[model samples]
Structures are given as C-alpha cells and as structure tokens.
Target: MFPIRDHNPSGRTPYITYTLMAVNILIFLSYVGLFSDERALSRFFFDYAAIPARIVTGDGALTLVSSMFLHGGWLHLGGNMLFLYIFGDNVEDEMGHGRFLGFYLASGIAAGMIHILSAPDSIVPVVGASGAIAGVMGAYLLLFPKARIDILLILIIIFRVFPIPAWIMLALWFGMQFIGGVGSDPNAGGVAYWAHAGGFIAGILLTIPLWLRLGGPGFWRRTDGHPPHPEARYSTSRIPKVRR
Candidate 1:
C-alpha cells in the first residue's frame, strides 16, 4: 500500500522538510544518468555511498553522512523521500529546524553503522534516505499514535484508499522490516532492512525526551493523538459510468 497523504498537517511551514526533499531529489537527478554506465556508477557509489566493509575497516567514514542523501534509482529515491515528506514535517516542527536536522543525520549515521556491524565483510554499497526517513516514522509513531493516515491499497485490478491510525501502519512497517532483516543475509546485498529497523527504533528512543517534554501522556490527552490543527477535507470522486 502507498500513502497518498496524511490527515495531520504541520502547524508550521516545515521549511527544513521541504528543503531536505528538494535536496535529495536534486542530488538523485544529478547522478541518475550514471546508473547507465556500470563502471561509472560503481565508482560513483564507491565514492559517495555507504560501503559497510569500508566503514568497518575505518576507511569510508564520510559515507555514513553522505550516503543518507544518495539513492540508487528513481523508485529508491522517490519512495524514501515520499515517506520523509509525509512524516518529517511534524517531527521538524516539534524538534525545531536545527535539532530536527541533527536528529535526522544522527539516525541515518546510526543506521549505516548498524548495517556495517550486521555485515562487516559485505562489499555492497547501501544508498538511500530510507534510514533517515525511517527515523521520522519512528518519531511520528511516538508523538501521534492516533493520527489518521490515508494509505492506498492495490489488490490486483482493484485499487482503494483506506484511513488507518498512524500506530498501526507504522508498527506494521517496523514489523515487516524486522522480519525482512532476519530472513535475509546482511552480507548479501538487496534491501538494508536492518538499517531501516535500527533507524526506526533509534528514532523512537531519541524522541523520548521530546515526548516527555511535551507532557508525555498528557500530550496525548491534549491532542487526542492527532495533530494540534484542524484536519483537511477531501471530496471523493464518483465512479464514471461506462457504456456496455
């Protein structure tokens, strides 16, 4: 299922979130062409993307930070940024711009380190903002458990949009990542499920202080688990009649 949007809107402009999304998209566009040239692309990733083995060997220290902004493909970049766009604004608003940016980077670096520890000998490059985005999702879950999110479900030829609570969707996503991480070999390259999982948990733990500052359970009572703003209204389209 895909998330079209959320009912919860940030109280502020969320400039940081917008800037982050634009930056990631711009960087991806700059290097997407390299993907066509295997040699050039490999070199590009080697230079900027996270290499777990290199990190374990104490060589690619900068990649832990740079890799959060790099992505391998359009879908890879799109999906990660989409998640960031959806959930990042609120966290940014809550943490303020500066702290939010620092939190994002820290979560991403931690994610890369977790991957390196999980597979120290693997030579594959892990690239994407997913780990950082997962951190945003983690924080969102703690702060807005009852917020309604619109998820688009595709069942073969059928397509439908369903509104579910934030906790359910985020929890399910975390569970999937855990299962995927356990089922696959970290040394074998595919999805960095462990990074996603670790980032998520880190986000939650990191947000604990902010949550407590916001009055902890009292905050939930005040907001009723939704954003502290009015929900947006969207009209449904009528199905068109087809001639037989």
Candidate 2:
C-alpha cells in the first residue's frame, strides 16, 4: 500500500516543500546519464554520496547534506518524492518555512551520522532523500495523527483505495524500517534502513518543542490531532452522457 494523498490541507502555501522536490528532481536529472556508465556512476557516488568509512576518517563530511539530494535510480527518487509530497506540506505548514527547512536538514544530518555510527568501516556509498523524507513522515505522525490518508493498495489483480488514520500508516512505516534495519547489514549498501529509522526518531524529538508550544496534549484536543483548518474533500467526476 502507498499513500496517494491526505485529507488535511495546509492553510498556507508550502513553498519550501515544492522547492525541495524541484531541487531533488533537477539534481537527479543531472546524473541520469551516468546510470549507463557504472564506473562513472560509482565514482560520482563515492565523491558525493555518504560513505561511512570516509566519514569515520573525518573526510567527506559535506556528504551528509549533499547525499540528501542524490538517488540511486528513478524508483528511488520517485518513492522518496512521493512520501515527501504527501507528508511534507503539512509539517512545513506547522513548523513554518524557515524552521521546517532547518528541521529537514538537521534530521538528514542526524540520519547520516547514525548510519556512519552503525557501520563506520563500510566503504559503500549511501545516497538518497529517503532519510530526510522519513523525518517528514515522523513529524506528520505527531502533528496530524488523526488526519485521513488515502492509500492505494494493490495485490496482484486486486486493487483498492482506502482512507486510514495518518498514525496507522506512519506507525507501520516506522515499524518496517526498524525491522528492516535489524534484519539487514548496514555495510551491505542496499537500503539505508537505519538512516530512515534514525531520521524518524529525530523528527519526533525535533518537533516536540513545537508541539509543546502549540499546547502539547492540549493541542491534540484542540485540533483533534489534525490540521487546524477545514479538511479537503475529494470526489470523482461523473462521465458525461453521449449524444445520439
């Protein structure tokens, strides 16, 4: 199952989220050609992506930020962007643009640090915005736990769309990350599950002050754990009748 959209709409424009998506897309496009050349791609990833060994050696420190905009393939980019698109706007709305941007960067950096700590001797280069986007998902869970998310479920030929609480979706996602992180080796270099899990926890901790400022548990009671505005309604258009 994948989230298609959320029922809650931000009261203001989320310019930062839009800009982040565009930047990630543009950066991915810049390196799309290198996919056909394995050596060149490896070189590029080694140079820009977060390498745990290099980080442990006190080198390539800038990669923590650079790596957030890089992706291994089209699917990697698409999946991360989809999650960001679905969850980012509301978090950005809650935190305001400047603070939200800072939160995103900090969470990503924390994620990279956690990954480096997890496998300091691994030479594999980790690249993707998933860690940062995971942070967004975490914040969304805390801020809008009751918000309805429309998820598209597909099982072979069976397909369906269902609306469920944001907390349920995010909780399941976090649980999967934790399970994957525990099951896989960090040095294997496939999915950075630890980074995702780390970023998620960081996001919740980072958003706690904001949540408190909004009145903590009382905030939930006030907004019912959703956006403090009217929910958006979606409907399908009926087919037009054909004239004889």
The lDDT leader among the candidates is 2
Evaluate model 1: give its TM-score: 0.96
lDDT (C-alpha, whole model) for all candidates: 0.89, 0.91
How many residue-pair clashes does candidate 2 contain? 0
lDDT of 1 at 40: 98
Per-residue alpha-carbon lDDT of candidate 1 for residues 108-152, written as tens digits (9 for 90 to 100): 988888888789899999999888888999999999999988888
Q: How many pairs of residues collide in each model?
A: 0, 0
Q: What RMSD, rounded to one decimal, does every model reach? A: 1.3, 3.3
Query: Per-residue CA lDDT of candidate 2, range 42-107, in tens?
Result: 999999999999988889999999999999888999999999998999999989999999999999
Candidate 2: where are CA atoms >4 Å away?
236-244
TM-score of each: 0.96, 0.95
Name the lDDT value of residue 168 in candidate 1. Answer: 92
Predicted structure 2, TM vs. truth: 0.95
